[model samples]
Target: MKTVLFDYGNVVSLPQAPEDVARLASYVTGAEPGFEDRYWEVRLDFDRGSLDPAAYWSHVYGRPMDGAGLDEVVALDVASWSRPNEETVAIVDELAKVGVPMALLSNMPVCVAEGIDTLPFMRPIGPRFYSGRMGLVKPEAEIFHETVAWLGVAPGDLVFVDDRLENVAAAERAGLAAVHFRDAAALREDLKTLLG
Candidate 1:
């Protein structure tokens, strides 16, 4: 059976809002500027479970964080990534209504993934694969291969969607049918061609 695998960040969920990012930055002492850049710079390690929440925040902040301070920062970080892309979510709802098999794969840290899991839209997707939990990040062949194995599907039978071109290329390299997600309308058209 064919499985539609969706990436959570920027594909299922909206991009992190600038305001939210700024709010997160406000909590870090002596690091207000270029916070977003720093956030992304150390994100892969966090997503791959190489660094725990305290370590990840400390890396981003360039200093150690107290337990309560780390908790607040983690909460703010999770809240920043919690918004859903309504257009894409609508498509997921439509697919679910038609009984299409769907799954979610995201290079998200455990803290953020826990927040995302509580969102209502996430309920429709089966078999979510979080990088923090899997100990592997996307654009890596092993992650894609592992997902295919877990799903018990041939690589060709899994339709993977990700906003990052590198991830899409990696999925293709793993022999899965991959779509470079641009926008909701374009993605709808692509899915129609692929799923129909």
Candidate 2:
């Protein structure tokens, strides 16, 4: 009730990396996977430390790519981060002003997450739990439980917002109130109802 954990990417402002994933994907499957989740499915493990980038690229791209080639793909993947939402930023500020602490928990790459930490939107939030740093990812029991432990709050008292239903499900199963965030509006309403 006092602290809310937000998923990064959409909730917090992040830089847009270049997009080579699409180009690679098109070459691989003849159809580009342009969205965040599609690209993320392949990338999340690497970002979360569950898989190495070289191994992942080897499996996905059909061959191992050098660091540069891997970065090209990751840049494109990070670029999928859309522009930040001003309204959400405002709400975060408002919530902070009310003495409600906000923390960021994201399934993000170390490089990308570190880059995001330098941005203005992340300034008010507490130390971000980037999967890379934690060696865990969302929709997984360890990460969710680790987040709860790191926050020092009971799961039942914390609320988690993510864009994935599976993530929401995991959070709920762990005893946290969960919201599958759609947009600033939906997030606004969910926070009001839960935190009101």
Inter-residue clash pairs, candidate 1: none
1-196, model 2: which lDDT tens digit per residue? 5578888765655334444434557644533544435445577777777776666656566556666777776555444554566777888888888888888888877766755676676678885788988988888889889888988899888878887789889989988888888888888899999998
lDDT of 1 by residue, 6-82 (tens): 99989998888989988888886679987778888989999999999988888788899768999999888888888
Q: Please give the distance, in angstroms, between residue 137's alpha carbon in candidate 1 and its true position after superposition.
A: 0.7
Best by lDDT: 1
Residue 101 displacement in candidate 2 (angstroms): 0.2
Per-residue lDDT, model 2, residue 130, is 87
User: Cα RMSDs of all predictions?
Assistant: 1.0, 3.9
Clashing pairs in 2: 18-75, 18-76, 19-76
